[model samples]
Target: MGVVKDWRDKELSISEVIRKYPHISPFVIIKTDVQRRGVNYTEKALAKVDPDIHQVEYRGMFREKGDATPVSLILRDGTSILTAFSVEEGKREPILVDVIDDRIVLVDQGEILEEVEYWEKPDYYDKFTSSGKPMWQIAAARPQRIDINPNQYCQFWETPGHGCKYCSIAATYNSSKENKPKILNVDDIAETVEEALKEPGRYESIFLTGGSILNGKELLDEEVDLYIEILKRIGKNFGGKRFPSQLIGTAFNEEQLRRIYDTTGLTSYTADIEVLDKDLFEWVCPGKSARIGYDEWKRRLYKAVEIFGVGNVTTGLVVGVEMATPKGFQSEDESLEKCLAEAEELAKHGVSTVGCVWNVAPGSVFFNQMSPSLEYYIRFADGLDQIRRKYNLNVDMDNYRRCGNHPDTDLSRI
Candidate 1:
């Protein structure tokens, strides 16, 4: 027999349990949890996806979309919840995205959570550029953002056992064949941006990111130069005035940072630290540790605030990764305490921290590891949100409107 709960059972419904923290939007909670658990599609749900109409993988880093896949879903309030292509074994059963009454909805244990819609296929997706490279590969359009990942594979991964454990960039890059030996064509990117902007208010921000490039006369000089050139070209689309854009790139020193700021129309900057603590940072991010060291990385991020100004510069952390086995913290409470402590340290330097739930990818080194618990994720998100509020930091670049990947920033809407 199935278990039934009375109205008094706080655990019966997420609504009942979350009522105490009314400030945290239900949408944010659902989105965070969905990202943490990922989602599965029913056969009926898969039958609903039409590649011609739905925006599936044309050129993505990981997990190609199938006709039966949910193609990613949005909540009733328009918040995007992505199904992590890499999920762990002992985690809770993923929610089933199903087609009910001709509508897409999240079904968990027989209860429907909310209705969802597929992201509209961008017009430029089908149109190929002069070189014949697909526009989707050149640029990916979100509801209100355009993503430009100029480089796909990180050179650090080339070193044996040095890539970030939670990351599957090299494997995904190999499998997808999205990687090329050459850099992405700047002209192609600029042309695609021009075409995407013709959609009439479909986009508000442009995002640029890629794998870490450690090669240069000075470390990352080539990487910085590449972004500056591309940003200059993209800036041409906005008529040379500074536009709304964020560059999630490798941590560069003040000189390189100044070069990018002075040379381009980039309004905000971010460099993902990936993990918070120094010891775990060395173990998980051996490449970054070997090159820049954790303390210097934090120093560079703080220096960015002086150039970009507070609220315009921030750093990103991959939440729950500090709990990886062998070198990770033992208990959830201890991990949360340590994580929040480091986030608070960054916040004091006027740098805000945005967290993405750890999605244990199959191709990554740490594929067999389990992520933190749902309750732990909720508390960790809440804790980070509280820190951001305390510091009066704003995350416009990585916010709900610009980037939908971070649960901590999504709470900023409140």
Candidate 2:
């Protein structure tokens, strides 16, 4: 059984939560809830998808069973609902996707909520790199961003109990026999980006992230070198010194960060802390805690602000992991209070916090663990957005357009 409780008896319904937080965007709330409780496509709904136009192939960190499924859904207001298509261990049922009036609409309990569109495949998605690798396999596309995961597997999972309990990167990579290239060829990535940029206003920015690369002369030196090489190649396309880009890599020392900043057109940086509470972090992400420690991770983020500038440096939190049973906080109130307090502290140091709703995956250690209530997610996102506003920080790199995975950053558009 999942750790999530029957919140219907304890908390407000989705409509009630929206009613209470009237200031929050109803579309964002619906997106958040849809992400929290994933979606299932009916036969008619799946038929609406055009594999050539709509994104139907799996790329990046996660892998699905078949060759195709809608990559993700897009709300009418340009809000991207980036979620996996999976049932959460029978803990909760996903909302239904059905065709209504020749449009795809999300259905809950037989009621149509809103119309949604599948993410469209970019022009480069069907092309092949000079190296004979499919360009789509090398890079993935969002509504306004081109995502490149050069390093697919994290080294932290090598140890018995090191990987983050809530993460499924290692499992996904291990099971993916077809997607074999672990680290992307720099030339292929550059070629893919060049082709993607030719699609006449299809992409706005480039985003890169992957599992932690722990091997280096000094902890993450090798990892830093890899990004510098990739960024330099990607930078060749742009004539300017810096292009609109973001790298969500592991926390590196000042020297390592400066190396990438000085060498490439990389614009923004992020190092996900995963969880705010130190104790819970150690329990949930033992590898991260053991390799870099919680305090040092924050220090790296602060140092990144010095080099990358304020608003350009951010940290992501797997919100609600602090409520994991046994090791996590016991109550939602306690978890929310503690998390926001820590987020506030980071914001004071010119670091913004972004929230990614925790959807316990089957491959994760916390697969059976339940996430927090929908109310908790709304309050958490609100708190993080308020913190960024208080600090006068901008999350343009990870905002609604660039990377729409975070609910907190999604608030930046409004």
* lDDT, candidates in the order shown: 0.80, 0.86
State the lDDT at 240 in candidate 1. 89
Model 1 over residues 1-414: C-alpha lDDT tens digits? 111233123232455436756767777777766776677777777767777777774324454455334335677777777663525343455666788898888877788877877777777888888888889879886668999999877988878988998889888778765446446898899889988989887899999999988889999998999899999999998888899999999999999999999989999999989899999999999899998999999999999999999988788887888988989999988999989999999999999989898877778888777777656677788898899999998887877767777777778777
Error of 2 at 179 (Å): 5.3
What's model 2's overall lDDT?
0.86
How many clashes would you count in candidate 2? 2
- Clash pairs, model 1 backbone: 46-68
Q: Model 2, residue 389: displacement in angstroms?
A: 0.8
Query: What residue pairs are clashing in model 2?
Result: 3-370, 4-370
* lDDT by residue for model 2 (199-228), tens: 998788888888888897899887888888
Backbone clash count for every predicted candidate, in the order shown: 1, 2
Candidate 1: C-alpha lDDT: 0.80
